[model samples]
Target: MRFSISSDRLKEALSKVSAVVPSKTTLPILQDILFELKGNALYLTATDLEISVRMTIEPVDGEEDGAGAIPEDKLTSVVKALPEGLLLKFESLDSNRVLITTNKGGEYKMSIEPADSFPAIPESIGETAGFGVVISGGVLKEIIENTVFATSKEELRPATMGVLFQFKGDEFIAVATDGYRLVKIARRGVVNLKGGADFSGVIVPAKTLQIIAKSIEDEETCEIMINEKHIQFSTERITIISRLIDEKYPNYESVIPYENNKELVVERDLFLSTVKRVSIFANSTTNQIKFKLDPSGFVEVSAEDVDFGGSAKERLDCAYNSEPMEIAFNAKFITDILGHIDSEKVLFKFGSPTRAAIVQPYEDSEDREMLMLVMPMRLNA
Candidate 1:
């Protein structure tokens, strides 16, 4: 392929698709990115079999319409090392090689493989009869950020290793759990379904959601297409296709308790800081921290490491009127659930020391509702 593109533009395009390029793969072709120059646009694609990313850069000076595959690391390294505003020219050379020359007379040559050797890109599902929606990129990013962290990393239970997405009417819900903690975000009127189609539940791998969150601008619009086996997220210039987790998600609703009436409201930042500090003295194996709540408007956070004889405690003012109770939890889990809360004050509802505690923002928006559940640990006598 022969084309001239600005170094910055080329670098941006390569960076977007490089995430999918496998670092270690048995198939050598998966290490390279396919570059196709046609008309005035250049297409860059990379895939690791499970997930694929394709990006398009337009208005490049196309000298000849051609395609080739080049090592992603080599091309990205060369472009990133060059000056910012220099225009780079790419040309196919003899003997299965590609030559890159900068406007300032810098030149680099790298081996290239025939484009046909690369794996076939997945076909777009936009036009097919499937569930499709147009969603704001900001909303999508928020949903992914709030829940992706809670996804399980265990390979045994593949269903819990990804976020669950459900669509009904105009409401969209995303849920993720790792057995110890779960986060569920529900939003209404945020996504516009094409043809008013709805899908029940689809587990999306956490890695895919993370890539989509970083690939698109917050203010842009994202087009999502979903079928039985795959899901696609597309922006104006970038497209990502990922295989859906085929396993059925567990019955999540049955675990969420609705009778958690004992409420304790505390400043989110203050409570989070206390938990982090107290966690330093928690047992290495358990990482357990205790919450001593009193009806007198205060909660004491404490942790102890009996093996090493380390202990710490702190008292924080809160709004609690229920009977006095002591609950314990994994300090790490509490910190993670607290980090995602966006409100000044956080509300915690407890049914008992053994029941799962519910955490949420003190005030929820009319269009968005977020609820996080963390299973408590048994307090030591």
Candidate 2:
């Protein structure tokens, strides 16, 4: 392949596609990026078996139409180190090699592999085969950020390693949990279906959601296509395809408690800060901290490290009229849940010390709702 593109443009495209390229693979070919030049547009593709990314760069000076694979690390390093405004030319040479030359009179040659050796890229699901949905990039990004962190990192529960995307009529819900904590966010009328089609749900890998979240622009719209086994996300110039988690997700709805009448409203910043400060004295192994709530509108946050003989306690005023109760929880988990809440105040509902506690923002918009659940830890006798 032969083409000329500005160094800055090429660098930007490479940064996006190279995210999926495997750094160390048994198959060396997977480390290279496939480059295809046609007319005045260039296509770059990279995959790591589970996920694939393809991006298109147009308006390049295409001298010839061909395809080749170049080492992703080498190409990216060269482009990034070169001057931003310099035009970089790529040309294939004899003996399976490619030459890269810059307008500043710098040249570099790297071994290239024929495009045929690369794995077959997944084709887009056509209109007749599967359903497609369009969502605002900002909305999608927010949904992913709000839930992806709660996904399980353990391999035993494959389903929990990804976020669940449930579609019910026009309501879109994203859920993630790691057994100890769960995040569920629902948005109404956010998913614009291309046709009159509905599906139950799909488990999307957390890595895929994270990549899409970083790639999409707030002003742009993202097109999503789903089939039985795979899912695809596409924007104007970039496309990403990932294999769906085949395991069935646990019924998360059953775990959410609706009968928790005990409610405590506290300043998010104050509670979060107190928890963090007290956590310093928490047992390193359990990271356990205790919350003693009083009907008098005050809550005590305390932690003790038995081994180190360290202890801390702080009292924060809150809005709670429930009977006095004490609950224990992992300080780290509480911090994570509180950090994601964007509101000034946070709401906590408790059924009992043994039952899971629900955390939410003090206010929710008409179109969106977010709920997070954190299981309570056992207190010392």
Candidate 3:
């Protein structure tokens, strides 16, 4: 089978689809992008069994239609290297090989797998009043950006490795925690069904959702459909389907305490900078930095590693009440969550020395989003 396609257009489309290819896979086909030509479009697809991406490119030039799978990265590189703005056409030499040529000059003959050898890709999702949510691209992107860092890299608790969505009537809540800290964000207009209300216990891997977040264009909103095992995201031209992490999310509810007494408020930028500076000298193993609150409303960020002749300390104006307190935390965790919070000042609360102090924007919280929680560190005993 043969097809003539525009060089620039083909490169742009193939580049998007090939990003899903696994760098190494036991099945060679999993390392390649499948190209299927039908009617007036070029269908480029790549998958790693668990995650799959299929992108379609509208056709061009004299073309005969066919399907084939070629080395994902190699094919992408060849198309990218073709002299800019040239037209590309490809034809299958046999069931297992293809020849690529361009109008302005450049050619490639590559071996590939039969289209039939490709693994099963997700099909168009069936409608069943499926669990759905819609939010602006900007909102979704920012929400994940702010919370994904809180997800666990350790897969011991698979649920902690993904973001959880809890639908509560007219609103929805998103929570993420890595056993170190937790972040909760809320969005409005979550449809809650009646009669025990349909709920989706879907946890999306932070990394996969990130890719889908990036693919969303400048559109106002996108639709999300959740099945028991898979979730589908659709934009105007782009569609992303991912297998949901099927694990029980921890009772995040239990981890969040109902009462905490001590509180400290500091300018967000000032606190972020001071923490960043003090972190430079933290222990390599723990990356622990200490915070000292004074009765006079001052917070000092400090860290020291005697082995490396490293130490740093900075102070910032803040709000403090009750007994003065000192706490330590993983510097990286502090900086990561701080970077996502968008407020002028942040509130830090402490229940006691052993508990993590909750960090949150100290502004007029017009809505009810939960506070970001961080577990305290153990200082020298």
Name the TM-score of candidate 3: 0.90
All candidates' lDDT scores?
Answer: 0.91, 0.90, 0.77
Q: By the lDDT metric, which is better: model 2 or model 3?
A: 2
- Residues 18-46 of candidate 2 have per-residue lDDT tens digits of 88888899999999999999899999999
lDDT of 2 at 378: 90
- Candidate achieving the largest lDDT: 1
Positional deviation of residue 71's Cα in model 1 after best superposition, in angstroms:
0.7
On TM-score, the candidate that comes out on top is 1
TM-score-wise, the better of 1 and 3 is: 1
- Pairs of colliding residues, candidate 3: 7-88
- Backbone clashes for every candidate come to 0, 0, 1
Clashing pairs in 2: none
lDDT of 3 by residue, 152-225 (tens): 88967888989997665556678899998999887665434343354645799886777766666655466677
**Per-residue lDDT for 1-381 in model 1, tens only?**
799999999888887799889899999999999999998999999999999999989989999999989999888888888888998999999638999999899999999999899999875866653787788999999999999999999999999999999987788999999999999999888565665566787999999998888888899999888877889999889999999999989899999987999999999999999999999999999999999999999999999999999999999999997999999999999999999999999999999999999999999899999999999998976
Error of 2 at 104 (Å): 1.4
Cα RMSD (angstroms) for every candidate in the order listed: 1.2, 1.4, 2.7
